[model samples]
Target: MSQGPAPRVLSDEALSELLGGQQFGTLATNKRSGHPHLTTMLYKWDPEARVLRFSTTADRIKVKQLRRDPRAALHVSGGDVWSFAVAEGEAEVSEVTTVPGDSTGQELLAMVRGSVDPADEDAFLQQLVDERRVVIRLKVQRLYGTALDVNG
Candidate 1:
């Protein structure tokens, strides 16, 4: 199998930076009625595979819509720094990875540091898991954005 695209659209380093920037984007999915549903999310980037992964509830409206139609788009932009990344492609939702409440708590705290307290980690995780359902991995089939045509 091919290791990657003919020309790496986004370098591994750049992808990692994108993730570290904590730059969230509005993920838009088509509802059954053919309207859009948007939501904010934090993503994990896998450099070697060049994939972006994020989690959401299985019963979420967006997730349900995605099941009906896999097409979706991600709108990412920055203000402090003038930048943007817009990607449109298909999405896949994995079976919920049953992580322990404490582990999920730690991951959440890491994502939003001081906002959460160490003491309430377990309780918060349990609450979140009880509410949300699945983990989503978005494989970007086409990525287009500012600062992307450096070589061209």
Candidate 2:
């Protein structure tokens, strides 16, 4: 009998690439009941800053959970079934955007617009205010992942 190949620990660069290359991931926040609250989120990865940014409504449960416990983990798929990555960090939620064109609104605009500007900048800002949007900044402290060697 022969033993099967074990999963290889992915390098830091590989992990960062996987996280940065993808826009969606599962965000796990610590609940008051000592369990994890998971939510599928669309996020922006800043490799240089080692931070993940998410734009969400201020009234969301995830926000409330994070407010109680700042610890969070983001799990991102590595473009294959055998590959994946998890980023653990402390999340800081911004104050809900109240006035249009405020700092929070501007940051939300950048996160949503990326390199392009929205068709109606004022309308976009107004919408951010109306939606009670907040930015969750996850400052990644540790990155770890593994890839299984299925091809022998």
Candidate 3:
């Protein structure tokens, strides 16, 4: 049985590039009572270090759920492009105390916004920061990404 991570058919660079499309995926975690909690999110598969990082509002049930438990799973897919990635790990919560430069700034900002509402995203973000929603970092232990062969 091919177990633990995915087959390394694609190189790290290819995998990273594949994951760079910013696919909106679902995240799942377990509660103390064994109930599963799931939330939609935007994520990136950092192939260099094989880390999956994502952002979410701290006040959300997902965040609260994480506080109760750290285990997490992410499902990422990018349309008909035939790319998908899955990751499992311990979600670490912290304040995103750093800002990005021009290149990454837009992406980072988009992530922050995507985590919340658009009507008052800034206020929501500020509230998130005030309420400490600044970061939703997940430290992955196991990950696997495969380029789905639709024809197969």
Highest lDDT: give the candidate number: 2
Residue 107 shift from truth in candidate 3, angstroms:
12
The segments of candidate 1 whose C-alpha lies over 4 angstroms from its true place after superposition are 1-20, 79-82, 97-129, 147-152
Q: Which stretches of candidate 2 lie over 4 Å from their true place?
A: 114-118
Each candidate's lDDT (Cα)?
A: 0.63, 0.93, 0.62
Question: What is the lDDT, from 0 to 100, of the residue 132 in candidate 2?
Answer: 96
10 residues in a row with least lDDT, candidate 3: 97-106
Best candidate, TM-score: 2
Tens-place lDDT per residue, model 2, 49-95, is 99999999999999999998899999998867888999999999999
- Provide the TM-score for each candidate, comma-separated: 0.62, 0.93, 0.61
Separate clash counts for every candidate: 1, 0, 0
Per residue, candidate 1 scores C-alpha lDDT tens digits across 1-152 of 64532332455355445544655778889987788888987665554565666667777887878788888887666333335566677888765435545444444445455666878766666766676546566777766544322322
| Order by lDDT, highest first | 2, 1, 3
Rank list by TM-score:
2, 1, 3
Positional deviation of 68 in candidate 2, in angstroms?
A: 1.0
Give the range where candidate 2 is weakest over 10 consecutive residues by summed lDDT.
110-119
lDDT at residue 2 of model 2 (Cα atoms): 96
